[model samples]
Target: MSVRALVVDPSAPAAVRLGEVPDPVPAPGQVVVEVSHASLNYGDLNDARSGRVPVGAVLGSDAAGVVVRAAADGTGPAVGTRVVALASGAFAERVAIDTGAIAEVPEGLDLAKAVALPVAGVAALRSLRAAGSGPGRTVLITGASGGVGRFAVQLAARAGAHVIASVGSTARGEGLAELGADEVLVGLEGLERPVDVVIDSVGGSQLVAAWHLLAPGGSVQSVGWTSGEPAVFPPYATVGPAKSLTSFVIEGGAGPDLAVLAGLAAEGALTVEIGWQGAWDRFTEAAEALRGRRVSGKAVLEVSREERRAPALLPQG
Candidate 1:
């Protein structure tokens, strides 16, 4: 059996298109998921354009759907359970993932909202936690209008940190105050008060600016270099670690973290803002919007029923 999936055609100058491919089968500790909705991340966009994802390889690592096949090993979620997973070929109609890659989507949350929790939501939680944000502390989040940035802002605020949200344009700053941002800056300029911590997603100049504004004993947790440029800092900047800067990628096996985020989202303590919601076939438009920074929050793509409602392969004994 074959399924429809979004693949990168390296031979076609890295074109992204939907193609029919073989169905995914679960390994010993893995289960097969019927993807219903997926979120577009900055990483996926970069991978598609760089042509480094390999020719004919399915793209995307974020997806929320139903598990139709339980692991043969009898471990992990049971069949018919809805989950959000870090499946590499998530852009496809179905994907096989291990227990480490999935978390049950919380009650009262739809698949689309669930899709936002795995990568972007988990990144936000981890980044804020890394900053050690807590009561009476101040945290600044770069690219606050973006997917991870939005989550970081909310999570930081929830942790009792004074949250400062930064965006490329003032227009993007609207309603951020409601999201618990004490301040919203169009740019890093006029930063009268330094922050205790910084969650930087916009690298390059933005990261440089955030680093410069870090308060003594403060730290910056760097993630997502959406600027697509290298960040350079002065040699004197690293003199004596009064301030610390650490870069990290979102690692897998964060299912518990995703579950926490899902609960917060379901309770309205955290908001999952989907800036652009459309059919999966509109992936090109969503990708362009994300790459151009035209989206204020996350862009969610709804896979068609024809894809997600495929017949289950697992047979009842």
Candidate 2:
């Protein structure tokens, strides 16, 4: 049987297109997830544009769904368990992912919301820990309306840091105070106050400004380069007493961290901001919105509705 999926035609110079591919069969230690929803990130936009992913790739990063088939080695979650996973070819009616990348969805949490956690949540969780964010530390999150930034804001606040959010526009900064940001500003202009930790997603000028805004003994965690510009901080920016600047990407093997984030969302400790949602066929619309920074939070896609009780065979395209 064939299932619907979105594939990136690397040479065609487009974002994504829907097509059919053979249904997945689990390998040992892999589970076949009947996808319900997926979360789109900024990196997804880059991959789509530059064709950074392999040619003819089914491009996607995170999904949440019910397991339709467990691994033959009996190592994955039960076939019926709902889970959030980070995997390749995730923009599909179904996805085959390793057991290690799948985290059982916490009770009473929507799969759509859980889908938003894996990529951004893992990055925020890891980066905050690396920045030594904790109670009494002042943490500044740039691009605070984006997925990783939103999570970092809440998680840092949960960790007892006085969270400050720097957004692209004053309008986008609206309501961030409710999301655990102690202060919100449009840019680095008026908020010259130094912070103990800077969770920077908007690199380039924002990154350079943030580097200069770091206090003595402060750390700047460079996560994403949304500005599409090179980061060039002055030498003196790094010469401060005990100041540090480091970059990171989400380490893929983070099932436990995904689970922790799901639990936090389920318990109301973390907010999963889904700024846009629609059927998977509208992927390009979502991608464009995200690429233009028109989306303040995650743009999620509803890949399939409910469980596919029986795999239906559709016309081979």
TM-score of each: 0.94, 0.93
Candidates in order have lDDT scores of: 0.84, 0.85
The lDDT leader among the candidates is 2
Local accuracy of candidate 2 as per-residue lDDT tens digits, 66-108: 8877777878788779999988788888888999998999898
Candidate 1 lDDT over residue span 176-242, tens digit each: 8989999998988789777899999889988887888888899999887878788788887767658
What residue pairs are clashing in model 1?
Answer: none
What's the CA RMSD of model 2 in angstroms? 3.4
lDDT of 1 at 155: 88
Q: In model 2, what are the clashing residue pairs, if there are any?
A: none
Q: Which candidate number maximizes TM-score?
A: 1
Q: Where is model 1 poorest over a 10-residue stretch in terms of lDDT?
A: 308-317
TM-score, candidate number 2: 0.93
